[model samples]
Target: MDVPALNQTSASLTLFCLPYAGGSAAVYRDWQTRLPGWVRLKALHIPGRGVRYEMPPMHGWPELLDLLVEDVQSSVSQPFAIFGHSMGALVGIELAHAIRSRYGHAPIWFGASACKAPGSRERKLDWLSCPEEEFFDQMRVLNGMPEELLQNREFMELVLPILRADFHLCGSYELRDREPLECPMLVLGGSQDLEIARSSESLSAWARETRAPLERRELDAGHFFINTHRDTVISLVADSLARAFHSRGSGVLPSRSYA
Candidate 1:
């Protein structure tokens, strides 16, 4: 399949961001202004959310990846990077594998935020079988759902299914062993994210799967660190992209030596 048409400007790097489950492209709306002139930012909007609300949400992983790979390959052409949070992180990693296998182009850098390392234990929660109120409470703990929606029955009717489906997809993922990726992996976690382990050391396992460098940074926020620490998160990502751009040209992608 042909890749989607890329929107290009003069920027030296293009970043394709994937949002967390139940999130839309709008989640990264302000990122363009925050990034340096050398970098261009674009967000991939999955169906059943945002403007594509008419389309059904994708439940199968392979189908979802195919659609994303087609769209992303069409939409970007410059030296590019990817940043995915939570469910998006898994998507980003799988997309990396797809791009390499199909197009032979690898992202210069990959930012996997708020996700366990590939092949890590999957946390299972049967939200579908739980009471509606109980399921909402779990979402509240994650800090993404707005208070107004939780109280409004009409709004809950529309959003709850999408949320449940997303949670199910994430919780049910099965990891198959594969060769290490040949690109840099930047793993970021929030200090207070209850779902992820407290120690940043667990993130280092991601290094074993990449030939390029591995870097880990912990933010002093919870699961939604992107929202809670926007400035800090953006700055760190910008700096890493700049460094990756420079390193790519120098023919020295940093070594993945665990600290």
Candidate 2:
């Protein structure tokens, strides 16, 4: 696995970003203005997307996590935070676990957006093996895939495989017994996210994955609210990083109780 550096080196804490299914590192290219001077943004480019198009994407958790964990170990030398959206949110959890297990340390902050909390028994549709026409229809309904890509035969021919591989990875995921992290977590949801509202009890459920305090926010947009409410999302992230910095020195986190 090749880890692409999204921004130049900085002494600030690195905020590693993992993108949603069918997303590339480029999704976060415009975040520089939103991030604070003390935070450096790094976006991970998974295989089968962007510059890694030639490499086949892995569908299983064990193999994909191993490669990603190794990448994180080798690439991250500074204190870091992990942020992920949709499928990437699940990646963030396992990545944080692997980091803690190997280095005896975890991220300063971890944020997951637009994803169902792990262990929710909500059955996701099998977009991977579904008929091509039906799968395309599902993509249309989800509003994740762009119309331009779907309309272009050559582009769809290229991206559909990657999308299917990512969807398969998400659909095949199963929860395992893993120790929770002590790092603070932020859970973001869009107000109109029917999938999240229908699948999980609430964002509070993310609390189960971490021992430290978890902050929850629901934006006024849909599942892709990160784009619609980018500034607010960035502000929340900045606040989390600030709290983590202060807490690191004081050895205390802000008090909060989750349901």
Provide the overall lDDT of each model, using Cα atoms, as 2-decimal numbers.
0.76, 0.77
lDDT of 2 at 149: 74
How many angstroms is residue 33 displaced in model 1 relative to the true structure, after the best TM-score fit? 1.3
* Poorest lDDT segment (10 consecutive residues) of candidate 2: 250-259
lDDT of 2 by residue, 1-259 (tens): 2222222232347788999988888888878666755566888879987777788977777888887877678655567889998888988888888888878878878999998888763545576678888878767766776777778898888788888888888887777898888888889998787667775565678899988998888898778877778778877877776677557663333221110
Write one digit per residue (lDDT tens) for candidate 1, span 86-106: 888888888888877788777
How many backbone clashes does every candidate have? 5, 0
My TM-score estimates for the predictions, one after another, are 0.85, 0.86
- In model 1, the runs with Cα more than 4 Å from the true position are 1-11, 75-78, 123-129, 146-148, 198-202, 250-259
